[model samples]
Target: MKVNCPTCQSEVEWSAESPFRPFCSKRCQLIDLGEWAAEEKRIPAQATQEELERALPDIEEIEAMLAQQGDSFFRDH
Candidate 1:
């Protein structure tokens, strides 16, 4: 049975158990990902949960943000 795509409403001919069930083709999958990346339709955080946990926090790396914070804030640190 053909499935209707939620985005373009095009018919997809994927088997029920196919790994690529939702996306009819690789191009469609990549296009969906591009939309998400370009739109930034995800949680708005300074960093993702995985990134914040895995990566080391560096003040120098975010020096521009540092400049905005008042000296009193850093002086307290």
Candidate 2:
């Protein structure tokens, strides 16, 4: 089978002996999670339309808080 590394986007060969079969390496695996945690990449919710309508305000508030603290919380430099 074949898979691509989530981080480097390199081609990954799958085999029993390949420990980093899915992610390319431990670092790459963690990088993907970091992307998720930092919201650098987005994941869609399974909520219905009505739920999303009700959730927009909450999401906005969360984004506002993140914007306020994000520079301090996740500093790149």
Which of the numbered candidates is closest to the native, going by highest TM-score?
2
Model 2, position 8: C-alpha lDDT score? 60
Model 1, position 8: C-alpha lDDT score: 42
Which pairs clash in model 1?
Answer: none
lDDT of 1 by residue, 1-77 (tens): 88854434456776855344465543333334334433433323343335433442333433434456433432212
Please, what is the TM-score per model?
0.37, 0.42
Query: Total clashing residue pairs per candidate?
Result: 0, 0
- Superposed by TM-score, candidate 1 places the C-alpha of residue 67 at a distance from the truth, in angstroms, of 32
lDDT of 1: 0.42
The C-alpha stretches of model 2 lying farther than 4 A from their native spots are 39-77
The lDDT values for all models are: 0.42, 0.50
